[model samples]
Target: MDKNIIVSWMEAGMIQVPNLLMQKYKQIGLDEKELTLLLQILSFIETGNEFPTPEQLAERMTISSGECSGVLRKLVQMQFLSIEEGVSEDGIRFEKYSMSPLWIRLADELKFEKKQSDLKLTLLEEHDLYSLFEQEFGRPLSPMECENLAMWLDEDGQDPVIIKAALREAVLAGKLSFRYIDRILFNWKKNGVKTLEQARMQGIQFRQKTKQPTQPTTGTSSKTIPFYNWLEP
Candidate 1:
């Protein structure tokens, strides 16, 4: 063998296989020949061979064309692949194969996992929020207060950050009560302050409005106007 030919062969191109597919094939009960056929299909996709016929696939493997066709039928029956007709680049209609079932299954699994993870996180957040309220109140939360918190998280659709902001506002106002916090949250919802940043901005605007001094109704003159003289009486 020519040394240059050997070097070129050694530097063969690569194809990427998703780890999910590799990890899931056994679960799908694919046998050795079926797995090899799956790999060959993947290779076809990598090399821009969108629709490899049974004969073409058999040429690349030890299987006969009839056997390759049987395997293709079995794969389609198992929902591992699908075949559709499409116009090729030369305007000739041909069969187009798709392996979307695998991706669809993977996507559903990922969504389920994400939902589970989010549920766990929400439970943790609920516990932490309860702890925070108890710490601020210097006592354990009453069952009513706990129910209110649950309602805020689940039914009221309040963000945890907004809830915390409401609590901080109540603490600053020296109210330190669930009713006060709930009132703050209600006001925030009315004002469309769903995020922490929006809550802070709303707080600043409220403070500015309250901080502005009321304009004097009386004239600048030291002599009090008769209209304002009722102040002395």
Candidate 2:
């Protein structure tokens, strides 16, 4: 409502608090008072005051200067904050509060959380793939079979969908064995069949070249099997 007051506010500028810090302060073990104090220090630093005294910071916060001092010490001890000594052009030593450590810790926390989430997703995918294999075979996979599956995923970097397609090809060809599935995957990879559509097209082309028409099954439900013999030359 007041133009002069708005102008003054605009001229005073503002301090930037990281969105990550607001979202993850509690996760990083910072309480309300501690967070407020850190914000005060950030404000001072933004205004060219790199090293504000505890009394100056406390004046803008709800806590007393003594409490501010204690919190600052605690932050330093936790490696979330640090005081670094620097020399000015006049060769005078001065101490400044550095928030680099806090930023580093927050970055590390984010990385750790992402790594954990990826690990969980990978484990879930692995479980589902194993279940699919076991259901298709109608038996629990042996330890060696499980290891091979893991190798295909982790070592060979095989796409899970591609592996599923290979398995389906093996089943349709009436050759449901790991060795056969492995050969199918190998041939698909060698021929640059990365996607399910590409693999299907390749199978169709191979069948057409050999003049093998899919035989229709007579039952309540009819099924067409597109079988490709990967082991054949």
Candidate 3:
């Protein structure tokens, strides 16, 4: 390896992944999934010699024990680990798991993109709407919220069209709050606003009327009612 080229890549990272390392990885005994995980394991080890536990791997991949096992077996077979090593999240090498020199060297060359790609696999494979909602809300979505959201997608009765219209209204208004959607749904239900066409028409009417300023009329008909603001209450 040319020292100048090596220096250039190393400058890009605390440690750099080399094309030669990738070429060497190609000769390893592993399938695609194992290959990818191998690269990740190598990256961490290369960067810091950090070995993640199978449980952590499962969470990261959103995979089952059996699936993680299959991948782990390949790692062990390919000499990524000879023994199952256990370590807490903190950096400690309390146990020994037999791993290959190539794996170690490859790990040193690991990059963030590989780790992030593994995480993206979990996101794409899992039904994370529940967790996503929890993350946004700072609390888990309630069973009622789940049911309500589900109802929006149900194919069986209750016009899916109406639900779509409501979704569009929220999107167009740049107001995606469940509270606002709930209010729209509530008023729609009360007023028998069942179809998308009906809701859209109502939405248009609302836009038109809100854009129109209130006229100052005389007589006792004009009354400034306090406490009309929901946020104030």
Candidate 4:
């Protein structure tokens, strides 16, 4: 409706509240009242009032000036807010509120959460890789085998998908040994075969180059067995 109200609202402007602050306020130990107070302080700062009095802040809040003062003290004590003193251009001293500490704390919290999420995903991938290996090998891995698998993951930094592709290559060649799989993985790594599709294409090219017309040995069929020899250059 009203044109004058709309103009007044437009002139009043808006305050910016970060999504992260809204989502993580409780986790960071801020209650609803404290969060509202922080937003009010931010709104005042945006409107050219960096240091609003408790009574002024209370005018737009449900809390009284006394409660507002107590919350402001708590915020300062918790390092979420700071008041810095400065001399004006007229040589008069003044105090202004700073929200830098709150922002820094929120940034640290986000970083810590991301690190935890990454760690969980890595652990899950490692577990799935181990299970796949045991299923293919038809037995639980020995301590030495487990260590080698971990080395391939943690030290060599091999992708779990590429490792699985290597295992499949060994199985297809009818040479289902860990040594053969390791050799395939090593060759694939040396040739920069980092994905399952790349490994398959490389295998096809190697077999084509090495294809030969074979004379079957005695008691063997004439059909040639197709296998890429990873051990050979």
Worst 10 residues of 3 by lDDT: 224-233
Q: Candidate 4: which stretches are off by over 4 Å?
A: 64-67, 82-95, 212-226
Candidate 3 lDDT tens digits, 1-233: 89999999977455355675556564444455665665556555665546566665666565675788778876666556666456667865465444455556466546544788867864453335445545655687788977876664453234445655655566667666666665666666667887778888888876665555455677645444431111221
Taking the tens digit of each residue's C-alpha lDDT, what string does model 2 give over 1-233?
A: 89999999998979989999999999988888888888888889988899999999888988889988999999999988999998999999999999998899899999989999989987888788899999999999999999999999999899888888888878877898999999988999899989989988876776675565445656645444445567876
> Candidate 1 vs candidate 3: which has greater lDDT?
1
Candidate 4 residue 50 Cα shift, in angstroms, is: 1.9
- TM-scores for all predictions: 0.70, 0.77, 0.30, 0.77
Give the best candidate by lDDT: 4
TM-score of 1: 0.70
Full ranking by lDDT: 4, 2, 1, 3
RMSD of 2: 6.8
| Error at 185, model 4, angstroms | 2.7
Expressed as tens digits, the lDDT of each residue in 19-131 for candidate 1 is: 97777676665677887887788778777787898999999899999999999999888878888788868999987778787577666667877899999988888788889
lDDT of candidate 4 over 160-216, digit per residue (tens): 888888888787778888788889889888889888899889777867755754678
Off by over 4 Å in 1: 1-14, 19-36, 47-78, 88-93, 216-233
lDDT at residue 136 of model 2 (Cα atoms):
94
**How large is the C-alpha RMSD of every model relative to the true structure?**
7.5, 6.8, 18.6, 4.8
lDDT by candidate, in order shown:
0.79, 0.88, 0.59, 0.89
